[model samples]
Target: MSNKPLTYLAFIILVLGGGLLIGANTMPGDWYQSLAKPAFNPPNWVFAPVWSILYVLIGVVGARTWLAFRRSMAMRLWFAQLVLNFAWSPLFFGLRDPMSAMIVILGLLVSIIGFIAASWRQDRTAALLFLPYLAWIAFASALNAAILVLN
Candidate 1:
């Protein structure tokens, strides 16, 4: 095992932060509570726990890729998805614009899919971890679209 402590720590932080960044916009007293959500929208309590778990998985998948392929395309795609993931928080919750958030989420969805595909090429386990995230985002995108149209 490599004793690259700092590198490992950085990867851990990246994964956790990347995961947190996804639901950064969905908190109470933010745009989320203000909006008239679809009846199908999940209860607010469901988000945090789900996202926290996903964050851990995101970190694991990233670590797996780094372990398996080091500095390869998987790493690049991972970074791409992370950047895209970070952007969603400000767009949705911070700005409180469902339309804008929708666009950002759609773009993020694409990047995540790309990340999944790229990660899949190197590590199937890592790619599988991203699947739930992708599906959740898809569901979120639909909810966002509904809010945009309804509001």
Candidate 2:
């Protein structure tokens, strides 16, 4: 097998598997259930499918960026966002600190935008792939803010 396929596979597994592990460990439990939520808060069932798709898209973008521009700003932003992405769940669900989670998510959103802007000239497809994830996270950021206000 060529290095390209292996790189894609490795990144997909890294992103998707890491997301699954973090999600499984940081599942919303009674603490989350007890907290007040915004009216627009999505149902529990909605998160899995949305995140699953986003993770794949993220993985693909990461792989493409790694292959084409390993040391570029886009790659750095990708790593930065992944760290923030992985941290949000634990901070919000495991530690049950919406305030800290909110901070991390804002940084995540910025890093995502940075990635898109950095990738736009070099790889439009990779940049486009991130649009849905951006929209979802933007919604999630609003939802997070609403939850903080409500509760």
Candidate 3:
């Protein structure tokens, strides 16, 4: 457990978390508040904390995978998913298009699954770390679909 890898991990985590924070800061504002939400919609306050946890988990998984496998396909998929994750907020909130956001989420879900599958052989811990992320994204996909339908 060298401090070097840990340092890299911390840097990766901060970068990923920063992206999430930037997205979160771009509040949907009145446009989002006026939308017809589904019955299951979580309160607006729920997103920040949940996403914060998920981003940290994602960063951990990324660090582990990178430490173990460098720029492997699993790492690539992880990066791909992160990019898609970053894209969702702007599309859904900034652009105010739930439909397009749903599309991005779908891609994110696929990338996440791919990352998990690829990471499973390389590092089970890393793969396992993604499970909660997968679950959350699944829930998010459903939420996006519901918003598209309701709005």
Candidate 4:
């Protein structure tokens, strides 16, 4: 394998993280507190640390997958899911539309499944990397659905 620097991976993380922070900021105080949360709603503090790690994983796997394939269809799906993942922040936090956000999360979930399939078809590790992300989003989607139903 070539020894190309993984600088772009860090850049990807930075881009996703920056957008997440900005989106999270758009929510005013008590934004989460007032929501019709579920029994499994993670503690407020859990979000930042968890998301930080997840974002880094995302970037690394994405970079690895991209590097492995010069121009594969899976590579394109990887990006499509990334965009959808990034879009969730604004739809949920920035707009404060739980219902709309739920819908976005559904799309995000579907795209993630597609992305993982693409990742798995080419690179197993890349697919493995997204497992935690997929699990988390699945739980989050459940929470979103619950919130929408109760609220």
Give the per-residue lDDT digits (tens) of candidate 4, residues 1-151. Answer: 5544555556466656665776566653577577777788787788777878778788777777667774877677767777777777677777778888888888878877887887686788888988998999899899889988878
Best by lDDT: 2
Q: Which ten residues in a row have the lowest lDDT in candidate 1?
A: 22-31
lDDT of each: 0.76, 0.95, 0.84, 0.76
Q: Write the per-residue lDDT of candidate 2 for residues 61-142, one digit (tens) a residue.
A: 9999999999999999999999999999999999989999999999999999999999999999999999999999999999
- Which stretch of 10 consecutive residues in model 4 shows the poorest summed lDDT? 2-11
Q: Order of all candidates by lDDT, from best down to worst? A: 2, 3, 1, 4
Cα error of candidate 4 at position 135, Å: 0.4
lDDT of 3 at 113: 96
User: Measured by TM-score, how close is model 3 to the native structure?
Assistant: 0.90
TM-score, candidate 1, is 0.83
Question: Model 3's lDDT to the true fold?
Answer: 0.84
Order the candidates by TM-score, highest first: 2, 3, 4, 1
> CA RMSD for every model?
2.6, 0.7, 1.9, 2.3
- lDDT (C-alpha) at residue 46 in model 3: 91
How far out, in Å, is residue 67 in model 4?
0.9
Model 2 weakest lDDT span, ten residues long: 1-10
